[model samples]
Target: MPATHATEHSITVAAPPAVVYGLIADVAGWPAVFGPTVHVDVLEEADPERGGEQLLRIWATANGRVRAWTSRRVLDPAARTVLFRQTVPAAPVASMGGEWRVESTGDGTSRVVLLHDYRAVDDDPAAEELIARAVDRNSHAELAALKEAAEQGELRDELHFVFSDSETVAGDAGDVYAFLDRADLWPQRLPHVSRLDLTEDEPGVQHMDMDTRSPDGSVHNTTSIRVCFADRGLIVYKQLKVPVAMSGHTGRWEIEPLGDGTVRVTSWHTVTLDPEGVRTALGAEATPAEARALVRKALGTNSSTTLRHARRFAEEARARA
Candidate 1:
């Protein structure tokens, strides 16, 4: 009997070959960058010259569920290529393997080819087309996101004053508390955040450099200290250094654990105005009421976007666990 298979897709990204390679090469970090759709757990690291390869356990969630697979990496650093073979353990009906090749195209552009070879374990003719189409769609989406992140440099400096309200996932306080304590996960999940360096000043107090992006494509670098009140189920972050537009800004995140493994999270941010810019941006003639309304609108939009990403992260973490 002939082995069943699926199709592959490719896309070119406008970035240096190294950058493109680095992004994909950092396979263990995929879950944070790729959102909740894909999870890559690293079983081994890469050592290119010695013919060492990375191994990853892959899980993909779609239509409210997850499917798991194991892949063995075969990487060629000199050629800038990484290939993987899917090992299907239980689900014999489907299999997938792919290669990522990066080549330099002059003028700081790189051509990326993502090719996949897939086979259906069982002889299910009808499922082949469906699986192929789904794989194509997913591959395209993944490339598009990678392109954006690469070209945009992953860190964004788009800042805004905002308020957010979140109810704990599954209504569990302990889970919520544990999740919030892991601030390291934020940089992985939020695209606008490039790096979050943290230092402990004292017990329960941590200082951090939050390198984030702003709405107008500017980078906002803020240094803040977070005081954790684990017993009270609260964490407060007070900004020490902020951009001109966000001077005197302070933000706080509060998690009130409700029974049944859920918590209510609320975030409040206050900004001190720069008279010159605010007057010019909002118009010197605009009243305080108008300014407040405008600020609220911007904040609301930011909050909504943040919440959507946060929810996806929380849901995926729960599912994976």
Candidate 2:
């Protein structure tokens, strides 16, 4: 039998058990709430005798490297617990399982405990050391962020928002996807892009460092990681470096065929504003509402520009063919 190591980390959150549980159960929102999480997708969900079972694909930063894995989870809302096991663990990890339990401490508070059990392939000491360190670091970061987000309560809504911009293309979805996937050419094709460096060390995964020129002629530098799904006509990205007034940003580009020889190409964005950054960027008395409006306008303008260019590119390509 393979020897397994177990670890636990716990934090006290000044929020109700149900509230904390809701944050954990809503896996789709982890990227915005947690520092290490980049993206999560629910592949399947079903009600089972044990509770609710779900298959999840999660992309996260582990020990400074971006990794992807599939996990099977059982969620018990009444018990305020979630049990998860990695069905496809990333490298250096042979097997991994974990549980998130939220217990009421009374007085409108909860104790959140994160537990992990894992084993390294071939019982290699080096692999074991790496996995243990990553697990500890990520668990601590996740718990701290969870506490901060949960404690924000109503304030979270003001600081976070989702928005999108789109255009219709009378061309193929593949052409639209190609235009978005080829970020390396943006500096030449897109007027707002001044310089961009893109690297794809792994297929379908891209790392980008770009300098974008704002309408005021001020250039802002940003770095991002993007995962592309050509067959699905989708590309999802998370910005590692954000603007001064933003705390987090994640977005996706989708191309959907309308079945009429045309496609709807859309850009979706989710952003969380930073209060201190907002004050610095705007003014000392700047409110969250003002920051929200500024972000919406800036991102929407850029997205709309990109969508228009993509539509033109795709249509022109079709015309030439």
Candidate 3:
């Protein structure tokens, strides 16, 4: 018989059910919400937040070692719960599944429950314990962070947007992936980049800190965590630290090969505006219209640069192959 293990943890946060649910539903923000999570990549999005399936690539620390895995998840806002199972289980974990439940305890409060059920690799007791430790530690941190985020302010009504650009090149997807996957070498390859500090503490997972010169001639320093999905030809990144005007920022890079002997490289971004810091980031003369336009242009410019560079590099690499 396979050794099965179950673990559950709960916390009461002074926030509403919907508020708590939103924090749980936004998988991309897990790096900030959970202490152990280094990055989260959404392979496929769940649009409705309820009765919709979402596929995710998660990179987290287990017993001090970074681990990466993908999960198939379903969300149900009405029931205030989300369900997930590992689509590609990592080592020491044969199978794993879990759910998030948020129950309203009062007008301005909620009780959040996190549950997990799993069987270890080879049904070994040692593997089971390792998995349990990871789950327990992460679940607790996530719940507490969710509670804190909910009680912060009325952020649910903030503006969120995604911008993307793509370039078609006569190269293969492998070259494109190699270029983006290797960020430590970006400073030498990309001009706008002034400095870069990168670490792949875990394979396929990266912690990157870099400085870039914005269009306005101002240098901005940002810290982000990224996860690469080699199979899907995708890479996802979330900023753990950002400028004052942004509340959340997440990005994606995808390399696809077309039948016509051309490959397309695309970069995408989703960001939420921080209402309280807009004036400070932009000058006093900046209107809401101007702020939005500036943000879109800036983000689009950077992503467009990446796509173009990847195209050229990939084509050259493919030519030699």
lDDT of each residue in 57-139, candidate 1, tens digit only: 76554322344567888877778888888765324336678788888988899888888877655756665665666567677
Better of 1 and 2 by TM-score: 2
Q: Tens-digit lDDT track for model 3 on 220-243?
A: 999887888798899988787888
Q: What is the TM-score of each predicted model, taking all chains together? A: 0.49, 0.96, 0.71
| lDDT-better candidate, 2 vs 3 | 2
- Write candidate 2's Cα lDDT for 47-115 as tens digits: 533469999999998887789999999999889899999999988899999899999997999999999
Alpha-carbon lDDT, every model: 0.62, 0.92, 0.81
Off by over 4 Å in 3: 1-57, 61-65, 70-79, 82-99, 106-109, 115-137, 144-157, 283-291, 318-321
Clashing pairs in 2: none
lDDT of 2 at 231: 86
Which order, best to worst by TM-score? 2, 3, 1
Pairing residues by index, what is the TM-score of model 3?
0.71
